[model samples]
Target chain A: MNRKKENGLSSEKVFNFCNCAFLLVLVVIVAYPLYYVLIASISDPYEVYAGKTFILPSKVTFEGYARVFREESIARGYLNSIYYTVLGTLVSVALIITTAYSVSKKTLPFKKTIMVFYVITMYFGGGLIPTYLVVSRTGLLNSVWSLILPGGVAVYNVIVARTYFENSIPEELYEAAAIDGSSNLGTFFKIALPLAKPILAVMVIFTMVAYWNDWFTALIYMGEKSKYPLQLALRQILIQSQATATMMGNMDGGYAEANKITELIKFASIVVGAVPMLIAYPFVQRYFEKGFMAGAVKG
Target chain B: MKKGKQGNTNAAVPKESLWKQVVKHWEFYVLLLPGILVTIIYKYIPIYGIQIAFRDYNAVDGFFGSAWVGLKWFQRFFGNYNSVRMIRNTILLSLYSILWTFPIPIILALLINQIRQKRFQRVSQTILYAPHFISVMILCGMLRIFLSPYGGLINILGEALGFIREPVNLIDSASAFRTIYIASSIWQDAGWGTIIYISTLSSVDASLHEAAKVDGANAIQRIMHIDIPELIPVIVIQLIMSFGNLMNVGFEKAYLLQTSLNKETSEIIATYVYEQGMLKAMYSFSTAVSLFNTVVNIILLVAVNKICSKLSDVSFV
Candidate 1:
C-alpha cells in the first residue's frame, strides 16, 4: 500500500508538472500575437517585417502611432465608435434589464407567452437582407440610430439577466417590498436594480465589447465613410488597403518605403483599435466569469 | 377566523382576467413595452418582410406592390453556377471548424482544472481569454500581416527554420482559406469557450476526486472517471448548439479574410447573401438565398436537438 501510494504521488507530480507546462505554452500561444503586435507597432517597420524584433523591439519609433493619430478618418472613427459603444450599451442594458425584470416576475400577465416571443427569435430570424431592408425603409440608414436601435436587445443577454434575477434575488425581498406598499417599479428600481450590479456589469461589458467590435452593421447601414466605426475604419486600412494609400500618398518616399510605413501603420491601428477592450478586460474578467458560470449552470 | 376567511375567499376567487392582471401590473407592462416594440419593429417586421422572397422586390414598387414570383428567386439561386460551390463551402467550413475547434476547449478546461496552483491557473486563464476581445477585422489584419509573402512572420520563421525556400501567400490561397479560418477561430475563441466547461468542472464534487484517489486511482484515472463524466452533459449540449449553428458561420471574419483569390473557398452563404444583396443590390434574389439559409439553420437545429435527446437523453432546445 505504501509503495502504491508513493507511485500515485509521483504520477500526480508528473501530471501537475505536465499540466503547468502545457498551460504555459497555451498562454504564450494566445498572448504572443498581441505582444508581437505591440512590439511591431513601435519597432521600425522594416525590422518588424524582417522579423528581427521578435524578442525586443529594434529601432523603436513612434512614427506609426504618429501617422495613425494624424489620419483624419481614423480619429473620426474612434470618436464615432466611442459614441456608439456608450449609447448602444446603455440602451441595450436598460432594455435587457427592464424586459428581463418584467419577465422574471411571476405575476406578469402572459409571462410565458412573452418569454416565448423573445426565445423564438433565438431559433429563427428573417436573415440579413430583410432586416437591412427594414432598417432602410424605416429611414435609419446612414444614421447613428441605425447602429444603436436595431440590434439593441440581445435576447440571450435578456434570458441570462432574467435567470440571474430569478435565481439570485430572493422572492421574499420583493414580497417584503410589496408589503411595505412599494410599487412594482419602485421595487425594481430601489431593490432589484441595486442587487443586480454584478449582472449589470456583465451586461454592460458584453454589450460594450460587442458594440465596439461591430463593423458589419456599419458596413451595411452607413453610406457615408465619415460615420464608419473604428472597426470599419480599421478594415479600410488593414483589409481593403484603401486608406493606407491615401494616408501614405503625401510621404516623400519610394514604393518600398511607403510599403514599410503602411505595414507599420496597420500594426499601430490594430493596437489602437484593440487596446481599450484589452485594458478593460482585466477589471471586468471577474464579473464576466461569474456571469458565464451563472449562464452555464442554468442553461 | 377572519384571516382564514380572507385567505379562503382569495383562493376561491376566480383568477383575474388577462387584461385586468395586465392593468394591475401596468408598470411591468410599461417596462416591457420598449423591448416588445423593438422586437416587433426590428425582428418581426423583418420576418414580415420575408415575403419579398416570393416577390420581385424593388425600392420603387415597395414590398407589397412588387410582383409575386413563386419560387422564382429560389429556383434562380439553385440554378446559379456558384450555388453548389457556395453550399459546399459553407457546409465544409462549418463542419471542419466544428471538427477542429469543438474538442479543444474541453481539453483545455480539463487541463486547466488539473493545475494545482490557483494563481497560476487564474493568470494563465486571463491570458488565454484575452484574444477573444480582439476584433475580427484586427484578427484578419493580423492574419494578413503574419501570412504575407513579403517578410511575413510565417515565412520568416519558415525560412529560418528551413521549412520552406520561399514565402507563401496563405491569405490569398484558396486551399489555405479554411485552415486559416479554423485555426484563427480556435486561437480566438478556444480560450473563451473553455469558460463554460471550466465553470462546469469547478462544480464537480471534491469528494468524487478524493474517493477515487483513495481507491488507488491515479490522476489520469481519476480525471477519466470523474471529470469526463461530469463534463459529458455540458459537452452534449454544446455539441448540439454547435450543430444547430452549423449553417450560421460568421460572415464578418470570412468576408474580411476573403481576397479575390480566396473567394472560391471563402464564399459561404452569409457572405454570398451580403455580396448579392447589399453590394450588388439584387434584393429579391438575396432575400430568397438568405431565407433558404435560415430555413436550413432551423431544420438543423431541430434535427440535432431531436437526435441528441434520443441518443443520449441529453439535449438543448
Candidate 2:
C-alpha cells in the first residue's frame, strides 16, 4: 500500500502523516508538564500529593496560593524583581543605543578604539570575586542599582544596535542634516533614533525578558532577604524544602506532615512566580524573530 | 602672547570634546548619559577586573595589591584530585545533549514547515511552546514523581506493556541522569528553538520548493534538497554557539538532579565552581577553575567559528 508502482508526484501522504505524528509527539512531551503543573497547582495539595489528580482536578483548592502569599517574602521578591528589571533594562538600553549611534558615525574620531574596548569586555570578564570586590568597595553592595547598573550595557546588544544603526539609517539623511548645519548629536537624536524604532522595540522586549529572568546577580551580590528577586526567593524556597524534608526525615521528631506540605508549596511558588513572564511572552514573541533577524544579518 | 594663545587652544580643545559636545547638546546627552553611565559603572568596570585572574587575589589585599600568582592557580587546578571527573562529565553531558537534543528542533522546524494546514501548525506550536515557560524546579518535580520506580506513570505504562517485572529507579541510577537531563532539555527548548529555525526557513525561496515539486521530487527528497540545505547556515551558527558554552553546564538543572547516587554523572564545571568556590569559600581556587573554563570556551569558540566559516556560510563572529 505504501509502495509506488509507476509515476508519483511526491510521498506527501506519508510525509504529512509523519510530520503530523512527529509534531503531535513533540507537543505531548513538551506540553504535558505545563498542563500537569497548571492542573496540579489548582488541585488540592492532599490529592496532588496522593497522586490522584492527573488529567483533571478532583478537588480544587487555592490554599497553596494563600500559603505562598501569606509567607510575606514572595510579595517583596516580586517588587525587588520589578525594580531590578525595569531600572536595569532602561539604563542598559539607553547606553546601548547611544554608544551604538555615536560609534556608528563616520566623523567620530577614534570611535574604533572605544568600540574595541566594548568588544574585548564582552569576551573577557574578570572572575567573580574581583567583580564582587568592585561592587563592594564602590559601596554598591545591597543597593538596588548594584544589580541593575553592574549588568547594564551588554556588549552583544551594543554590537547589534550598531549593526541596526549602520544598516537602517540612510547616509543621505545625515548628509542633509549636515547641510542644514546639524551637529552629529542632532542627527542621531532627530534622524537615527527615530529610524531605529523597530530595532528599539526588539531590544526593549529582549532586555525586559533578560532582566526579568535574571536572579543570579542578586543571589551573588544582594545578601539581604528584603532585596531578593523572585528567582532568588524561589531558589530559597526550594532550598528550604530540601533542608526541611531531609532534616525532618533524618533527625527531627515530627514536622513530617508540615515539611511535605512545605515541599508542595515549593512547587506552587514556582508556578505563581512564572505567570508574569508567561502572560507577557505572547505580546513580545512576535518581535523576537524580526528583531534578531534584522540585527544579526551581517551587513 | 603666543603662550596665552597656546593655553587658550588647550582649553578650547576639550570644549570641542564629545563630553562637551554632549553638554552643548545636553538634550541628546540627557537621553544617552543614564544608560552610558550605568554600563560604564556596572558592566565595563567589572570586566576591567580580569587582571585579578593573574594575581594571588585576597579579599583584604584587593586586585591591585595582590601578588602576581601568574598561572599558579591554573597549575593547582590541573594537579588537583578528581579534576578529571568534572572535565569528563562536563564534556560528556554537553556532548550527549548537543548530539541528541539538537536534531529534534531542526527536524521539528522542517516538519512544521511542511504542514500546509495552518491551524494544525499553530495549535501544535502553541502546545509545544507552552512548556518552555515553566521553571526548572516545577519541571524537575514533575519528573521525580512521574519517573518514580513505584507507581510512577511511566512504570505503570511499562507494566501494562510487560517491559519490566519491576520499575527502575530512574533518578537514582547514574546513567539515567543524563538521559533525563537531555530529554527534558529537548522537551523545554526544542519548540522554542524552532522559532529561530523557522525564521531562517521562512527566508528559503518558495520557488525552489516549487521547482522540486515540478521535478517530481518526493516529500523526503524535497526536504533533503531544499529544507536541509536552507537550514545549513542556521545549523552551523547554532553549532558554534552551543560549542562555545560547552563548559557551562547550567547550575540549576544539574544541581537539582544531583544526589548521592547520581553525582558521578551530574557534576560539571558550573556546579563544581559553585560548591568549591561559593560554598567552600575557596575563592581563588574557584575563580581559577571558572577562569580556566572561560578561557577554554573562548579558544573552542574561536576554533569552532573558524572551522564553521571554512566549512559553511554561517559564522557567529
Index of the highest-lDDT prediction = 1
Question: Which 10 residues in a row give candidate 2 chain A its minimum summed lDDT?
Answer: A243-252
By summed lDDT, which 10 consecutive residues of candidate 1 chain B come out lowest?
B1-10
Q: What is the C-alpha RMSD of each candidate to the true structure, in Å?
A: 3.0, 6.4
Segments in model 1 whose C-alpha atoms lie over 4 Å from true places: A244-246, A297-299, B1-14, B314-317
Task: List model 1 lDDT by residue over B23-75, tens digit each.
Answer: 88999989999999988998888888899999999888887889999999999
> Please, what are the lDDT tens digits per residue for candidate 2 over residues A190-296?
88889999889988887887777766677778889888887777766664344223322333344555655564565577678778877777676667768878887
Model 2 regions lying over 4 Å from their true place: A1-10, A180-182, A242-256, B1-55, B68-72, B135-173, B313-317
Checking candidate 2 for backbone clashes, the offending pairs are A150-B42
Q: What are the DockQ scores of the candidates, in order?
A: 0.74, 0.36
Using TM-score, give the best candidate's number: 1
TM-score of each: 0.96, 0.85
What CAPRI class is candidate 2? acceptable
